[model samples]
Target: MTTTLIIGGSSGIGLATARLLVARGDEVHIAGRSAQRLDDARLALGDAGTDVATHVVDALDAAAVASLAAKRAPVGRLVLTLSGSEGAGRLAELDLAALRRAFDGKFWAHLTVLHAALPHLAENASITLLGAITARASMPGTAGLAAVNAAVEALVAPLAAELAPVRVNGVSPGYVDTPWWGMVPDADRRAFFDGVASELPTRRIATADDVAEVVALVATNPNLTGTVIEADGGARLKAA
Candidate 1:
């Protein structure tokens, strides 16, 4: 069976992709920061015909990421849907420490996992990094996030070239209704989502499954590499 490793697969897009890939016949291995969450994801995939495994490897910890990457066998595909607090809000008053934390969560951690996992990658393996619409579009309170995401997206070209037959790409999704918004009050979150739905050309926010579908494509498509696929429901077509 083809082995696919999903980092940050305990929830959101990662987990959704795991379920989809498992259904389509792949040996799925998921990694998360928390043991409980990893167990929960495993339970969620219970009784699925395909094999699914879980590991507790915090993306923020280099040693943990290396260890997890070392143990896994050559993977045919890799998906990273890692999440972190982006310290959203006006930049002038932003907390420097939190800003640093946000960067560490995604871009830095992604490199950590990729570098370590390189040795175990199968020929023609695919790597899809979960990027963001923030990378290309301007949104209020997301200045820091935009920069961080842009940096993450920037890796595609160089990494894809370096990885060669191992295709490297990014899937940039816009405003998904994921747990990433749990910090927002219910009413405010609803208002925020409603606002996006109102203006977006697709008249809806991207969902975990929506992005997951694109991720699956990026993984399986042989002709694509060194590219960042935008799956933002046409939000970029609208202005800031």
Candidate 2:
């Protein structure tokens, strides 16, 4: 059985991807900062009757990530879906702390995971990172996220080359129907999605599974590396 480690596999795209992998008979190890959320995810997986392990980890903590990696055997794939800040502010007005936290969580945390997991990643294994469409199609109030995500994509290219036999890629997803919408008011959220969905060439926002399928594809494709598969439903072109 293929052993895969999913960092930040508690909710949103991470949880959805975990469910898909478990269903496909992969031995999945999930790591998240919240013990309660991890327990809930295990329950939601509903006794998949497969080998599933949960570890409490804060991806920002390099030592903690290193410790967790030391405990695990070599893995066939590693997926990093850590969340970043959603701070809504102009560049001049943005909170430096919030911006720093965003980069720490998503950018630096991913690097830490790679550092710790490199030894445990088998040859020809895959490493998938999550990015956002905003990285390419920037918008107001999301400057920090766009900047960091763009940097992450840039980082992937060199890492993919350095990793050589191991495939390193990323999935840049557009708006998806996830709990993130809860951050906005109900009416505003509805209006926002309605507009976003219509603007996309596919006439819809992406789903968690949609993104996961791309990740799975990348994981299994031996020849693919330094690729950023956009699961954005043509949202980028529409935005452009």
Candidate 3:
């Protein structure tokens, strides 16, 4: 069974992918910032048996991440899906703190994981980073997200090359239905998704399962690296 380490596995795409991996008989070690959430995930995935382990980690905490990485044996697959939210205002009115917060959480935290875990990554192992469709198709109030996501994509490319023999790739998901959407106000969430769904060629937003499957593929495909799989239900096409 493949041994995988998943950072930010408490919820959303990360949690979904952890469940999928466990179900497939892979040994999964999940980490997140919430002890309660990790415990809840461990309980929920109990049916997958003892192959699942959860750790409490703040990806932004370099020392904490290094400590967690040290606790595990060499890992065959490393998936980082750390998430953060930022400004809701126009670029001209953007909140600098919000921008920095988002960048630090999503982009820098991802880097921290790689820096700390690189030595522990097994040869031929795969690394997957999460990006958003907003990075490619811009929208109002998403300037910070776009910038950070693009940086993630760019960051992974060279790393993929540098880490060769150990593959690195990214998954840029569209509007996957997850708790991250909970960040938006309830009244606007449905309408916002509806509008996004209407514009996609599939006429529906992506499910966590859709993105999870892509993540799985990236993790297992040794031949694939430095590529961003756009699992967005053709949202990119619709955007054109």
Candidate 4:
């Protein structure tokens, strides 16, 4: 009977979490920017007769995001995994306009969704935000991402206090095998992942399912809040 709203839930960590939560007997509704992708994820997940809803949402539109929450009132768990790279490049070549757009996609999206859903959060509800190791494991060519992720982590403590029984926490994952990697050519991606793998304590990049385990843990734990569980395979330990 617990309903979870997963923004950006059509793929990667979001979709994997959807599957895991459903398997554990939770009704899930996935909102994504692409309807086709959402549908494909639903078919692949085969929600096991559990309620699995999908929506086409552009997180940049605050009104729409808020309206969705109003429509789906009483969300017991809210997980947001929305990610974008609008102005991703060296600071010297940065485009201010694109950077603003990127903020809307990531940081602003988090605020808007939570603001709209606050009224409907169930008792003892949990809110999980997907952060990145870039928040601390600063790598070159990731300045924008690092700033944005750090901003997200900055919200955990304050929001946790304000939200109270509705626990709010975050998870920062390292490189994972997800569609985000599909953007690279196979050979390059393999090489990159192999290079990262050798340095990783886990010796393997995380799968979406691997990160989902932590997301689920954060959602169900009653004693956790104002904290972030780093699921970055110890990448933060090595530094950038």
Candidate 5:
């Protein structure tokens, strides 16, 4: 059975991806910072009698992240869905400290996990990093978000080359409706989604499952390395 490790798999796109992979019969191991969330995820996955493991580890902790990867050595597939939105704002008004935290939490965290998992990666392992549409599209109030996600997308091509044989790709989604938006009240969130859907060509915001399909594609497709797939519901086109 393929052993897959997913970082930040407690909620949102990460957890959604784990569900898909678990359903596909992969031995999935998910990690997150919250023990309670991890337990909940494990139970959810286990209820279906799927093979799933949960680990509690913060993305920012280098040693713990490395240890998790080390323990899950020979991982056949690795998915990174860790990120932060604390840096979302106009450049002039952006909190520099928050921006730094965003980078540390998302960009650097991605790299740290990748570096830690490098040695343990299976010979033909696949690495899928979750980026965002803001990286390539012109989106106001998302300069910091773009910077962080752009950095991740920038690594895809070069890393695919460097990691040769081991495919490295990215999935960049636009305005996905995930727990990341829990801060917004349910009614307001719906209104926001409605507004965004009206503006988007697809007429709807993507769900975590929608993005997970793309992640699963990149994870399983043998000939799709060095590419960043966009599952933005045409938001990129609209932004363009």
Candidate 6:
């Protein structure tokens, strides 16, 4: 059985992906900062929870992340679904500290997990990184987010080459309906989703499952190294 480790798997895209992989019979180990949320996620996986394990560790805590990775050595598939919108705003007016926080939370966090698991990653294992379409699209209020995600996307090609048989790929989703938008009030979030859905070429905001399918594809397909699969509902095709 393939042992897969997913950071930030307590909720949202990470949890959705874990559900998919669990259903597919992978030994999925999920790590995050919230014990309760992790427990909930495992329960949410239903009877397949037998294939799931939960660890409470923040991605920002390098030592904790490293310890978890070491304990779960020989990980065959590594998926990173950690990111944030902390630094989102107009570039000129954006607080530099907030941008740094975004980087720390997203870019550095991803790297921390990657490096921590580097030694223990199985030979010919695959890595799937979850970023955002904002990395490529020229959006007005997402410059910081763009920078953070772009830094992540930037790792695909080079790492794929360096890692050789170990595949590296990225999944950049547009605006998925996930807990990432929990900060926005429910009504406002719904309205925002409706507005974005109308503007997208697909005419619908993606669900976490939608992006999870793409992540699974990237992780399992041997020929997909260094490729970035955009599951953005055509957001890049038409700016919002």
Once fitted onto the true fold, the runs of candidate 2 whose alpha carbons sit more than 4 angstroms away are none
Error of 3 at 85 (Å): 1.9
Query: How far off is residue 90 in model 1, in Å?
Result: 1.4
Q: Rate the local accuracy (lDDT) of all candidates.
A: 0.85, 0.83, 0.85, 0.86, 0.90, 0.90
Q: Mind giving the per-residue lDDT tens digits that candidate 6 earns over 1-240? A: 889999989888898999999888788999988898988887887887767899988887878877887787788999999977689889789999989999998999999888878888889899999889999998888888898999999999999999989999999999899888888999999998998898889999899999999999999887889999999999988864
Error of 6 at 50 (Å): 3.4
**Can you write out model 2's per-residue Cα lDDT over 1-240, one digit (the tens) per residue?**
878899988878888888888888788899999999888878877876245789999887878877777676678889998876454478888987888878887888888888988887878789999988889975667788888788777777899999889899999998988776777888998899998888789998788888888888887788889999889998778767
Of 2 and 5, which scores higher on TM-score?
5
lDDT by residue (123-235, candidate 3, tens digit) is 88899999887788756677778888888888778988898888999999878888888877888998998987887889998888889999999988768988998998887
Clashing pairs in 1: none
Q: Which regions of candidate 1 fall more than 4 Å away from where they truly are?
A: none
* Candidate 3 vs. true structure, TM-score: 0.94
TM-score result, candidate 1? 0.94
Which stretch of 10 consecutive residues in model 1 shows the poorest summed lDDT? 42-51
lDDT per residue as tens, model 1, 25-77: 88888998889988777777777623788888877677776677667767899
As for TM-score, the candidate ahead, 3 or 5, is 5
Worst 10-residue stretch by lDDT in candidate 4?
A: 42-51
Q: What is the lDDT of residue 108 in candidate 1?
A: 88
lDDT tens readout by residue for model 5, 1-240:
999999999888998899999888898999998999888777765664247788888877878878887887889999999988598999889999999999999999999888878888999999999999999899888989999999999989999999989999999999999989988999999999999999998999999999999999999899999999999999989988
Please write out the lDDT profile of model 4 over residues 12-84, one tens digit for every residue: 9999999888888787889988988988888878744246888898776777877887787788899999888
